[model samples]
Structure formats: structure tokens, C-alpha cells
Target: MLLALRALLPFSLALLFGCSSTETDTSTEGAAAGIALTETGAHAVTRSKVPFLWREQAYDASLHDSISIITIDQKLAEELTDAERAALGYVTTFIGSECDWDGKANPEFSNLKCKTLSALKLGYQCSIEHLGFLQHWFRNDQEVLIQLASCPRIPFTASSQQTFDEIYLTTQGDTINVWFSASGVNLPMNATWEWTEENIFLAQDDAISLVRTNKSEVIRSELKFDEGL
Candidate 1:
């Protein structure tokens, strides 16, 4: 009987180990489905969970006045964690605007518009006419690159039109950089000649400094990020 018990012990242990292994694999597979990691390894995680928070303060070198723009784009009402939603409550008073963050029935574009205008402070006359396409290119888990093909522009008046302005960003990891570019057609001749690129690098404490690629050009501005972004 002692010999039979010893022989059964090994089989029992093996069965237990097999069951544990299967359970582990099942759990891992379930997690993988939610995370949805691609084989290419470029995007370690999708943007659905992560909060896209950033504020950009751009200075007009010619006018010498800086504009503070805070953007919170995502399905914030639906996707934000309880903690994140609570964070919004703290800032509602300071944001100086009311928004009906109705993510359930709202489409992606309308949701973005509501999130942007509600969370950020803008002048009474200025209103963002449109929110353009947002493309997120993630290099890894720690790094995310975003390109705004047509950033929203607030026309001064109802009849006024806004030209297309493209912006790019590298958010996450250690350093973040942003670039703004725009072009327009010359009147009469109708030739598009002026296409400019203004690059800004992240500075200390929610600020960005102009990166002067041309040694001769004295173009500089201290673009700052808004708080609570």
C-alpha cells in the first residue's frame, strides 16, 4: 500500500500542475484580447484606454502674443476611469465652460468637440469650427506619436474662414516635441508659395521653446502647456 501511494502521488502532482498551467494560459489569453497587441510591435497598446492629455501654448512671433490651447481628445465620458472623471470635476470650475460629455450616443467627432471646448478656456468670440482627423502612431509602450492633419481653428467671425493647420506631436517617454505647419494660396496668381514649419521642443514645466534650425533666424517663442491636461 505504501508503494501504491507513492506511485499515485506523482500522477496527482502532474495533474494538478497541468490544470494550473491551463488556467494561467486562459487568463493570459483573455488579457491579450483586451490589450490587443499587434505582431509588428509598433503599437504596444491601443489608444482606447490611455488618456490623450496635452496643452500647447503657441506664440506668434510677429504678434508676440501666445495662445494657450488645451486638447483632451478621446471618449472621455465613457472610457475615463473613476479617478480620471473625478479629476475633471476639480477642473470644471476653472475651465470656465459647461459641456455635456455625452459619449454614449455621441459620435467620435462630436465627442471630441465637446471634450475640447468644455475642458479648455477660449475667448467668447472664438469657437472651434471643426475637429479634424487624429492619427496616433505608437512606436512602443512608452512612446506615442500623433499627427493632426487639420487642427480646429476658431474664426474671428461667423463668415470668416480658417485655413488648414497641421500639427504633429511626440507624446510619452522622456521628451515631447511639436510642430505646426500651414500653407495658403496666393491671391490673384493662385500659387501656394508660403509653406512654413515651426518646431517647438518641450521646455521645463509645461513650456516649449522654439528650436531654431536656422542659425541666422532669430525666431523664438516660449510655448507653454496648460495645467490639468
Candidate 2:
């Protein structure tokens, strides 16, 4: 199950957000306002009309490892796309989690300790791991960015195993480009699935186009955003 989901990741990431756009001179003002709120110890409210209803797929591959042609699950895509469409706003917040490590701790692999165990355990170390979340605010027509954010916290879940972080969005004329970068440790049976360093760009227009690269391989896919269930 984990392996299959990881296999679907590249395609899943591409299809996740490929719908709609916005235009306004106030866009910069809106972006700055959101940033200010974050700086002032508050979360920014995101508003847009691009119903999160985005569903599409592209070929998944890897240049650093073996490659295969895979498409994301259609039913799963429709469900998620519809859910996103219903969601109208997003904000950012941080919560705590648990992460444990032995020897020299790798910040990326483990940093939060959700258990009662002390960080100075006999042969291990632990700490309160803070994770980020997106809060839904009000709705409007200003552009905002959504990144992969965090890596998988639970090994058993499909989301944790195959996801992106730091998704950034920008616009050029009539095109909205979504870019995201991520890094993670390798998992069993998930060689090409684990990315040492990867970046992806989703170019949106009448149709959706993608360009993704990591370590050595590059993937490209063409898709269309479906607004209906």
C-alpha cells in the first residue's frame, strides 16, 4: 500500500492543484498583508475563486532510479478535487508532534517528541516537534500560495509517505505557476519515491502542464482541470 501510494506521488502532486486564476494590482497588497500577519505572530487569510476542485494526472517517473508509467486513482482524484472545491480559505498554523533520534540527530528525519520520554534518554534524544497546518479563513479573489509544507509524520499513512512541501505560487500574464520543493529520507521499497532534493512547477492555463526534476530525472505531463464532480 505504501509503495503504491509513493508510486502515485509524482502524478498525485501534479493533479492536486490545476484549476483557475486571478488578476489584480491589489494582489501584491494582499500578499504583503498575509506576510505581515505571519510576522506579527498571526496567520494570514487566503481568498480566491479558483474552486480547489482540481483533478488531473500525468506520467510518473524518476531519473535517479527505476522508472515506470503510473496514473493516479481516478476515484480518489475526484473525491479530493471536490473537497478542495468546497474549501474557500486557508491559513497557516503550527502544532506539536513527536520525533525521536539516535546518535547525531538528523533534523529532517526526526525533531519532535510527542511522547513523555525526555530528550536526554539513555541512548536517544527527543524534543517537541512542531508541525504546520493550513487554517481556512474567509473567501475572496486574491492569489495565494500553497506548498507541500511538511513530510510524512506517520509511516503508516499514504499522505506522509508521498507528499510535497514548500509549495509557492506566482503568475505571469495569463498563466499561474505553482512551484514546490521537497527533501526526505529513503523508505523501504520506495527508492525513486524518496527524493533527496526535488522541485516541481505546475503551469496552469486552458490546460495544465508540469515540469518536475530531482537528483537526475525530469518528468512532464499535460492535464486539464475538471470543475465538476
Candidate 3:
């Protein structure tokens, strides 16, 4: 059964990070506020009339050395297509948005903290599950951080609110794969990255892919109902 299940879940996934617009002007005023975002957050951005009621995702990060996987069952694409769909749901409704969840700059995120983790880890941590699959990261999505912030600590279950077992991040040019272990599990992915400049948020395009392999009988799936963020 374990082997059979593993065979069924054989997968490869990628995320192209970057947001185009914003939905809110957090420029209201705050001590942390550095500059009003050129882009609005998701709240201010208008979406299609539909919300995606179903979706699934798979992810592999070389830096984190983890492969996060998920599958969504019983989706209501038509109904989900309605207004105010979740970002992941919106992406499912339109795959074109796979690269970004929120717009590049939101006024609320003007003075974000310094990125502690290296670009590799930042990128890996940024890699997030969408529609149960991971096509992007949750680096700056306040709504996501608030709702699913607990996921990282939960046991690495594919079910609701579970943590990822192993996370991986591969250096640029397919030269190295950095591994970060959690709960004794191996990292879930081998990734490729390219660094054009030293900046963290450099405006460039690169494909992030990750995968995981295990000996136990674990289930990977995407559920239609949201567990939040």
C-alpha cells in the first residue's frame, strides 16, 4: 500500500514569485510604515466574479529540502468563480496568476522587517501551497500569514494545518541542494535558482520546483474546503 500510494503521488511542481497589483492602501499611518506601497494589497485589487471552490498543489524546495504536496477533491469551480475568491482559488480559476498572490507593493507592507533567512530559505519558505498545491509563496500576504500562520508548526500532514516534514533549496545553476530537516524527515525537493543581483526582491523571473519521497504510507491530496490560508 505504501509503494502504491507513493506511485500515485509522483509529482513535480514549480512557483514563479511576484505580484502585480494591490487591493488596499495601508498608507493610513504607522510607526513601521516606511513607504506607501506602489501597489495595493489583495483587498483593493478586483477579482473575477467567480471563486474557485476546488484546487490542489505540489511543491519542492531545495533550500528547505522539502517537498510539500496536496490535492483538492470535490471542487466547485463555477461557484468559486464568483467575486472575492481566495488568492489560491483565484489562481485555480486562472493559472496565469500562479506566480503571484498579492500585488508587489501594498501600503501596509511599506516597512517590512529584514529578511533573516538567506535567499534560499526565504525562497523556500516563500514557496506556499495553493489550492492545496504550491505554486507561490506567502512571504507578504498579511491575510495568509494571519490565517495559516499556524501551518508551519503543525505536523507534516497533508491534511488541514499540518507542517511540512522536510524543506529543501537548490542553489542556482543546479550546483547545490541545501537541506533543512524537521522531525527527522529528509528535505522534499531539489530546486534550481539563478541570482542576477544581491537584492532579495530583485525583479527577475525564475522557476522554483520541489518534490518529496518517503517510505511510509502517507496520503497527498487537495481538499475543496479551505482550512484557512
Candidate 4:
């Protein structure tokens, strides 16, 4: 069975949810409901059985605030067991202004677990707006997966566009694995996805694309996954 679930906030609502250095409440007791503040005050998570957490700080002067999933839980990154790290999936730090393409200065520590979808490249700027995450768990198997994606604004010949990076995590028995993918294609702001048992159908404007869940491959087509649409 396809047990799919996702979390998102409309652009307008997401903007209201955006946090800044000065506006954030540093106290753990004052955090929003269902959210817990990390010891360092750099991250927060939903207080539930399967918690969903995110970076709270946008820029870390010492770190230059580059984009990364490994640093999401900085304190725990070093403390987590290999198996625990894998189960957590690819945790990303808060979106900041800079992008570390070479991974030299600001390396994403768990690179082996955080595999990319396409050749990494430079872009204009990262967007914190509409940043979202999704989680999926198999009923019959001892496996769970989560994806954290962000759309960044990229300059195009005719206009600017939004691109995404798909970060995923999966667990099996005592082992866990993490994966990352970049949507090399530029898409409109309204792009959306439909999940099926084996594939994800992406729709934007009048075009549709199919993403194979197993191989992490994409197939573009002018027709919709469901012809009726």
C-alpha cells in the first residue's frame, strides 16, 4: 500500500512562519505548540512520536550559514550512532544566503548517506519560503522515509525559476540510508507532485514529469500521469 503523507504551508502562510535571528523566541518554553527547541537554540522539532524538526537559525557567522542537512542537529550529529543517523535521514540546516557547491569549506559531513540526484551546480539564491518536508512509512515492512525539499530561485534566459533538492531517509532492520537529489530542471512556482505506489508525478504548467522512486530517475512528458487531468 502507498502510505504517503506530506507537510506544507501555503506561500502566504509560510512567510508568516519564517523565523529570523531577532524575532525568534530563544526560550524552549515559549516555542510554538508541538515544537521543541534544541539545546543550542539552533533547531526545533514537532513534539510527537515521529518528530519533524528544522533549523531555527538562518545564519551562523562562524559557519557562514551555508545550506546543509548534516548540520541540522549539530549537537547530535557527532553523538548519533551510524544507525541512528541513517534513520534520521538527511537533516538540513536552516536555509541561508550562501551555497557551498564544492563542499570543501562547508562540507556536508555525512556525504556517504546524503547522495545527490544530479550534478551539483550554483544558483542565484536560496528561498526559505515554502520550504517543506514529507514522510512515508511502509505498513508491512520495518521502513520509514522522509523527504525535505526546498525551492531556490534561479535565473533563466527569459525569466527566473524555482528548482528543488529532494532529501530522503529510509530505514531497514538495523540499517538506515539517506539520499539527496536535485531537480536539474527549472520549474514554475506552482509546480506540484502526486505520489503513487511506485512513482511521483510532477505537474507544472502544462507539462508533467515522472520520478521513479527506486532509481531516482525522471521522465518528462507533455501528458499528465492521469490523462483525465
Candidate 5:
């Protein structure tokens, strides 16, 4: 995960949904979902779930072309109890640690120093809050779709509030955005997952596509895991 030090967005959010699109451009549905990684099959592989999520750009093999799923440790999932929120919060800490909390209370793309967990979490919080401040963007069906007249030129704030912006989290290792509710509003967000080459010890990436019901296809991510825990 440390190698992903350069990939992160500050002040992010997560609001996942289970519904996905049926379009065949790499269906991100759950057949791609439900992973139970083990010693032999520990390498990062791509899987597709039931519902296919939407993407601004159809398919870019250059970027992560498939959703990465690292099986969650049953013990941790049980121990965390509040895995949903707590896990997401834990991921937030990463964005903060990476961005170094410029202390401006605003989302700045240049704050790419996200090399630590604490920095990333702070960065996620700051960036998400700023995104929530956008007008004409809101959540429906527990999922959020942001829309702006024109996307921003800057990578960080360029599409923070745009409908078709290509959003992602490097700290989460090239995972797409997650859906979330903050300040009582549902917004598209990101979830973070941490792995030690093979095992899924932690997951913070929480985008709208990671839902348990009526899920959308836009939030699914993948793990290009290494072989061994």
C-alpha cells in the first residue's frame, strides 16, 4: 500500500449501492463479487459482479480494466463489528495522511503527499466536504451522481462536482469512487482496502457501487493482489 503513496484525493466520501448496469463493457457485477482469497489463489485477479457500473470513459486497459476483490478476513469483519463506517473512516485516515492536511479545509489536488494512513484520512475528509458543498449534486437511491456544466481542468477539483468526472483513489490502489452519506447527504465516495500482498486485512474503499441492495455498477473496484499473505 505504501507504494501507492502518490495516489490519493483529500476529503473524500463513500456511498455504495448494489445495483449495476447490464452493459457488456466489463460488467462489474457480483459474479465479479464475493471473494474468498486463500494461499494458492492469492494473486490479485479480476472479477465481475451482477450489475455493471457506469464509467465516464468506456474502457481503458491502461487504467484498471477490471474490478479487484481481495477477500475480507472473516475474523476482522466480525471483530470490527461496525465494519462499514469504521472501515470507511479508517480509509479516510489514509487520504489525510497522504495529503498532509494543508489546514485550509479545502480540497487541493496538489496535496498528493498522501504517503501515510493518517494523511489520507484527513485528505479524504477535506475533499469530500468540499465535494458535498457543490450545488445541483445530490444523492438518490442512496447513491450520488455529481453533475457540472463543464469539468475542471485541474485533476483534483476538476470533476469533484461533475457528473462524468473520472474519479478514483490512488491510496486505495487505483480503486474507483465509493458512495457515502455525510452531513445527512448521500454523496459518491471511495472505500479503502489494505492488503499485505495476499490477505485482505482491511478495507476502507467505500464507493456507491459497493452496496448490498439496488446496487449500481459504478462503484466496483478490483485487487491486483500478490501471491501470499
Candidate 6:
């Protein structure tokens, strides 16, 4: 499964990032907003509509691996063109990771991405799943942080699983911040911690769901917001 996913990554990256226009934009407004620009000076952008729904597949400790899937409702899926659906799945695969094992060394950083599990089909809803390798470092004494942010310019790769430290939810203007922390950080290093944040630009009814699995137990949380950023 891992090898198959790897083989498809290059094609996926091209399909996801190849459609941008070659024209350059000298507008100062874009620069002030921290928008990324490509080598050609064109804005690096994603066609994804804001507010994604996340679904985590069951975790198997024996294999030290798991999958996270994202999907849209049948109604929303119907409205998107084939290209749009593929882009949406492609972008959601990027994830940020910070892990502190043994509470002695600095946290290790990595990236993760979801692969196309089941694209649009007659009997299947459009969906993508990320296959991740759970790091053995995860323990009750260590801290692990996983992040999923929208509108990413590039995809990330990494996979690990453990227990979540804490779940936090806060709102800053129009964006919602969701932080997950654990108890094993080394005080001397003062390493930065990351969280999940989504800018609600469209689709008022859209939401994000988090699923955490530890052995046979599973905990799920859903976040919904009313305003747009």
C-alpha cells in the first residue's frame, strides 16, 4: 500500500499544482497579505472551497499505521467539477507534525498527506485517505502535535500516532483555532507548538471533525463556526 501511494504522488503533485496561470502579479495588496507567489510571480492559490470535513480511519497499533480521510456531502460533491474534486482531495493530504519522545531531545518535525482513496465513482463518494506510520515514540509520558491547515501551497509527508495531550478551541476574528497539546515537552528547549486553524471563507455549513484512536477506543470531535474570514 505504501509503495503504491508513493508511485502516485508525483502525478498527484503535478495535477494539483500545474493549473496556475503564468502571468505575473505586481500588486502590492497580495504581498501585504502574506500570499505565496510562484517563481513566475503568479499567486500560488488553491481552488478548494473553505471549510473541509475530516474523517480519521481506524488506527491499528500493531501496524503502527492509520489513515485519515476527508469527504464532502453528496450535495456538495454534485456541484463540483471533476477537476475541483481532485484538487480538494489533493490539498487535504498535507499535515504538520511535532513529536517529543522521552522528554529529553528536541521535538522531531515531519509532514503528512492523504492519498486518493476513492475518487468520484458511481457507488463511491469522492474521498481521499492518508496512510501514516505511527511512531513508536508515542507514550503517555511524551507529547505529540498534529496539524491540518487549509490552503497549503505544497504537500507534506510523515506519519505517526499516539495520544493527544489536550484539545483547544478558540476564535480569532473570523478564523477558528484548534490546538492539541500533550504533557511531555522539555522546558529548556521551548520548542514551538502548532495547531489546526481554518479560514472560513465560504460554505457556512462546512465544518472540521477530529478523530483520535487509541487501541480499541475512539474519540471524535466536530468543530463548526458561523462567520467567514
Number of clashing residue pairs in every model? 0, 16, 52, 3, 85, 7
lDDT of 5 by residue, 4-123 (tens): 321211112111111123233322333234333333322232221211112222232433333211122222223211222232333333222113334343444433322222211223
Q: Could you tell which candidate, 1 or 6, scores higher by lDDT?
A: 1
Per-residue lDDT tens digits of candidate 3, residues 1-229? 5333232222222121111122222121321132222243322222211111112233434333333332111122222211112222211221111122133334443222111111112221223432222223323344444444332321211111221222222222212122322111122332212111110111112222212223333333332212431
What value of lDDT does candidate 3 attain over all alpha carbons? 0.23
Output the TM-score of candidate 1: 0.26
Query: Looking at candidate 3, what is the lDDT of residue 65?
Result: 30
lDDT, candidate 6, 155-201, per-residue tens:
22111222122222222222323333221111123222223232221
TM-score of each: 0.26, 0.23, 0.18, 0.25, 0.19, 0.22
Per-residue CA lDDT of candidate 4, range 1-229, in tens? 1111001111211222232222322232332232343443111222222112232324434434322221232333343332233233222222221232333223322221121111111111222211211122121122222123333221211111212233333323222333433222212343322111222322222222222334434433221122431
How many clashes show up in model 3?
Answer: 52
Minimal lDDT window, size 10, model 1: 132-141
- Global Cα lDDT for candidate 4: 0.25
Report model 3's TM-score to 2 decimal places.
0.18
Ranking of predictions according to lDDT: 1, 2, 6, 4, 5, 3
Candidate 6 accuracy as lDDT? 0.26
Against the unseen true structure, what C-alpha lDDT does each candidate score? 0.28, 0.27, 0.23, 0.25, 0.25, 0.26
- The residue pairs in collision within model 1 are none
Model 5 ranges with Cα > 4 A deviation: 1-28, 31-81, 96-229
List where candidate 4 sits over 4 angstroms from the true fold: 1-52, 57-71, 89-99, 103-186, 192-229
In model 5, what is the error at residue 68, expressed in angstroms? 16
Sort by TM-score, top down from the best: 1, 4, 2, 6, 5, 3
Error in Å for residue 200 of model 5: 4.9
- TM-score, model 4 to reference: 0.25
